[model samples]
Target: MKIFVARLQGTPVFDPAGDQIGRIRDVVVGLRLGHRPNVHGFVVEVQPRRRVFLPITRVRRIEAGAVIFTGRINMRRFEQRTTETLAIGEILDLTVRFDDQPMTVYDVAMEETRPSTWEITSVALYKGRRREPRIVDWGEVSGFDTLQKDQGAAGLIAAFESLRAADMASALHDLPSKRRIEIARALNDTRLADVLEELPPDDQIGILGTLEPERAADVLEEMGPDDAADLLHDLPEEQASELLALMEPGEAAPVRRLLTYPEDSAGGVMTSEPVILPPSATVAEALAHIRQQDLTPSVAAQVYVSRPPTETPTGTYLGVSHFQRLLREPPSTQLGTVLDPSIDPIRPQFTLLQVAYYLANYNLVAAPVVDELGRLVGAVTVDDVLDHMLPEDWRERADYRDE
Candidate 1:
């Protein structure tokens, strides 16, 4: 794997049968799985339409000559088991060098390169303002090289642009509070959400404090209710109230509800965004409503087909459908068929301690909120609880410069 890692992508891959299987497009590893877990397989992109997986077990050898594989599997089976199909556009992004000269891999034809050796088939270059393609011989290249040429040369304009782009993508997840604040100040609301999603509570607070009340409210509205509540709880009471006042009622109301409970509890960290539909709507109507209103309601595996509200004096209390189950069954199939009656909702009164237990025990990313009468109201996301557990200013205070 390290040898291949040293070799740039678009390196040739071969089968034990001496068949020119494909070119190495991507090395798929089980990322989130346990540390040092098995290398799942390699994706060999034969052509635009013929990319396939060469599982780790199939490799007879992986030396300079051929990345010999056992046998071929059907494309459909490969797609079913793999995370994503390798696309030519992705491979085009690769930049490799042959004989120590610069070459781009974009214009390379799939069939041109020898399937058993490291080579370059094509290169993309900007001839003045227009881009030009140059095809080269793979066998002519001495060896493959990695793309790390622009580390120094401090004052170059091109170098600065390259560094700026790299820094944004490789930002430290555990940034200091002050740094977090600076990052928050610089990022727009949407990007802030991406940053905030990964930050701990202390960093979240520090970042939020740097913004004006209106801007802070905007950021909070973008955050889930539970996260917003947790942040609000950390702020000065007056500041918290001011920000709440600045937020929309729909957004503010849920955050306020979450604050009433302890941070660790389900009640404290649940989102109220899951739109509950009444049972009366048809599958087509429900689908239409979801399309029209952008409501992410609970649907059994397909699209959520929920029952309408009951005719009782209080209101209807329909069950949720986990969209996965919804798709497998027929469209006209009744909501009851897909809806799980056993979705034990967490009460708002439950403490954070109890909520954490529920999260740890359950496999759900989020759970539904309901009243004693079984009327659904909100949801509790795992991210909300995680935010609550993290330190509020750890990111900011980490900057102790060894005085």
Candidate 2:
């Protein structure tokens, strides 16, 4: 039961039967539940396994030869032993106890012998023991200014952030296309897509070309359809077709239709992914429907409020209403009242030149696309028309044209 304040590192630990355990590498404490916490447990770096956790209660004391603890404990009992082969979820849930307080271990680093790599590891809880921290119920950790004099951890982190921001594009540019694609695939799709935005079109296309079709499709899936279509249009036709084939047919089908339209036209500029709600749908029902759908804010704008399918075709369109407009109105208000009569929609057959003129004339980000039957099929944005009217890199080529 007695505890002593000793340097955690290099402290020899022993089991209940007096068998040698391992010296302490670091002790993880659980403060997971706010204040009133305790020691999670000591993470011991040992031979054969490299790292394992022992409960604080099982330990007898800090006073003697090697940290002494209750005997008969074996490496098999420690979750760290299986870490080399365990899945990430398994390792995260494994718990360890420190000084009788409960806490979970996380982000454990492990060594892979088969593949020869360092793996980060974690633990959940100790069997039958409470957990505690090395320093219990500790307040905010300060003293960063004192540590910064020697350029400690904080300095290193700041340096890394600076380096990443300063050289992200350069680093990506220098990387082989395959390696760049590998890095991109390793990142969250949204994060990778954001980085792709910063790169030049040529580099973006190069990196995407190097990726497996499915991975490339995943990244593109995160992009706005207009942006995704634009990126696809830049790829070689065969490569573009192959990557599109890799995507879910429903998701890719609309992109393919957009491709058929001249890039400058309303149909080409619009994403086919608009959120459609039956005209009879209540404000509350529409809100719920929008929540369940994965359409983007731009797509949500052209939410085609339509009549019920069973209803005979009405000559009238329920019209598009902005989300903000919906929020301002009572939930009971019918969408028919919110219908914006002033807006003019484009026919699917409109030429790219005609769509551009409408965009330039209206100064609008989006316009509706309707079929011959007067049913809304898609919506286009100004950017889509502009991208086609003025080809990407047109500014750079302007000099040659003038010459």
Candidate 3:
């Protein structure tokens, strides 16, 4: 048998003798990974402002808005366990993204997987006045558990681990300020950096403001230089300076350089941590270097081959070796031998449009940025260029592409 969780709420539970026990207030279910959660029990309101737990095993049948029980119910107050989530209090009526559209959950439909074990199977979404509510499988929805208070910050963060940073940020944006802050506080530095980079300026400021100064600096360091710089630019100069002072000099330098350029310029949006290799580096060495560092696919697409002194960007810009070329060439082949020098790098002051055209014309996912002396300083990625080219509120739109 199947029933909507919303319908179950407020239904009267009767004992074997047909005496009314109480009205159902909420249903509790234990969360499980890779499987539908089974209902544990129900919170039944026995009197005004009083609720008690009635185990599912005690219930004989549910019919016509009333639960018939086979045994006497425990009169003790309902106490939620760490693993339990309230179906009505936590999940029902929450906004979830479904079928590429935002939908409000009107009710959750549960199926009895076993004789006494019921698990949530689908959600009924509110459509319109004349239309019947749309039923969607539970797996088809995103953001369903994002704002579940029972999950706490750690559980909620784990539930969102599979989501892209942008998707997570979008979901978090809809939560109340208090919940958002609590979740933010629970995220590790690297994870927080990724989410912060995806959020809007106001949200970035709000979350960062909640963190301690040193902690905020640590998160900034973990982010790409361009993203960190952008966030710092939006903050008050004094506050930005304080945070910068807390960061390691090496990590802070690139952001400082990026801050010197106009926000929409190539240098401004370019990440300072490109895979730069000395001209002497062999294909094998380059591959090893890339493997050692955690890089996004776009950033790892190529490695810049520059002149000597690899540590602090002191070399003249030579060219780049695409990852495909590296794989095709022998391991002993020097990067300088197969460098693609035809692609001219973008200048610090180039406008966003110029950067876009340059990347498009070169058919490159990323293009290096150079100073007046023609030294490699950073690389502007296609994603960053498009981010600046798109409308300011594009992130808030339901159909916005997060890639």
Top-TM-score structure, candidate number: 3
Q: Which stretches in model 1 have alpha-carbon errors above 4 Å? A: 1-180, 284-315, 334-337, 352-363, 382-403
Best by lDDT: 3
Error in Å for residue 388 of model 1: 4.7
> How many clashes does each candidate structure show, in the order listed?
32, 39, 0
Predicted candidate 2 versus true structure: per-residue lDDT over 236-336, tens digit per residue: 99988888888887667667777877665566667665666676667776676566544444455545677654121223446777677788779988776
Give, for candidate 1, the lowest lDDT window spanning 10 residues.
151-160
lDDT of 2: 0.54
Question: Which lDDT tens digits does candidate 1 get at residues 310-384?
Answer: 321114355666655555656676665566776666777776666678867866656666667665556665655
Alpha-carbon lDDT, every model? 0.51, 0.54, 0.79
Task: Give the CA lDDT, 0 to 100, for residue 279 in model 1.
Answer: 58
Deviation (Å) of 153 in candidate 2 = 19
lDDT (Cα, tens digit) per residue for candidate 3, span 203-317: 8999999999999999999998899999999999999999999999999998898899999898889888889998888999999877765687778899998887554354898
TM match of model 1 to true structure:
0.49
Q: Tell me the TM-score of model 3.
A: 0.64
How many Å off is the CA of 169 in candidate 3?
2.1
